[model samples]
Target: MPAVKPDLETADAVAKPILIRAGVALIFGLTTVFVQEPSTLWMKVAFALYLVFSGSAMWEYLRREPVPVAMRSPLSMAAAAWMLGTIVLLFLSAPQAIGLTVAAALAVGGVAELVAWFGHRRAFLPARDQLITGLAGLGSGVALALGSHLNPHGQLGIVGGGAIIIGTLLAVSGVGMALDVRKARNLEADRAPGRVD
Candidate 1:
């Protein structure tokens, strides 16, 4: 039987979304520093777009065959849906309501990652990475929630800070994951018969 050749196109498809998301996160993080008000229309729109991009990237990642089945738990699906829903609610609901919703979603996502970590700890790479990412989400979520309550003005401080943290985290993780995928693909190609580097 002929060996299945590694598909560069497939590899690119998997890596592209992650890189794009990382870029967006980095850009958003940098811009958030200058944003004085979190409730502004532009900020809301940007966040809405972020949700859309994040949900799309997750959907793509879940579609990849290399991802473990254990990682695609119901909780993960719910988190993706919540992100999408938050985009809609950002425009329709009050700022505080949306902020609360985001905080809750982040918390749930963090818990989901923690579960994934414990469930698949033997896998090492994914388990450890998920734990780190999960902790980032959990910490940021808690901070955002606290900021909402502590500031009588608004969640600008919390949101801005959270954006920077989340952005940096996502960007780093995204790049790392992309590089891993690329390396795996290259290794597979090298192993194929008649293939030259």
Candidate 2:
């Protein structure tokens, strides 16, 4: 073989998180698969695990994507500050923790945008990619968390587990750029080229 590029460390750094994302996805997928019977505490533990995964994935996606100069100019420090503040605030909110956590995520995403603008000179996305991904991830994850609606016996198997599947769907959506691209092309082919294709 030709000389190997010496980037094992860098490659590992990148692969580690993507692998973690896949693992989390698998956990969620499996949770969905076996929604028939699971312990109450296990269900809660699974959801908690999901929350951690979402936070990690969001953190990675933001830091990796190139900031449009304008967006970079705006979001850097703001996002960093909010990310720290909300992590603490959301955790302390107890029963309302899930909702608070989602709010914090939204704020974190917003801050990322601001950081992007400040660091660069423009907004990274016209559609605010970070916000959309974060919210969907947060919302679905929370929906799953809140699924445990006081069902002493049924919470885990029914509500909680179902929510896990839903949250997994959201997470996949966030990470599915290639899928989106394929969908876009398919839709565009159905339309004429210039007509918003």
For lDDT, the strongest prediction is 1
Count of residue pairs whose backbone atoms collide, per candidate: 0, 27
What lDDT is reached at residue 82 by model 2?
37
List, residue by residue over 70-171, the lDDT tens digit for candidate 2.
443344433453345444543442333433443444344445543443443332222233343334434543543465344323433332343344345444
Locate the minimum summed-lDDT window of 10 residues in model 1: 1-10
Q: Mark the 10 consecutive residues where model 2 has the least summed lDDT.
A: 1-10
Which lDDT value does model 2 have at 160? 33
Residue 166's lDDT in candidate 2: 38
**Residue-wise lDDT of candidate 1 within 20-68, one digit each (tens)?**
6456555656666666554545555655665566566666666766556
lDDT of 1 at 166: 52
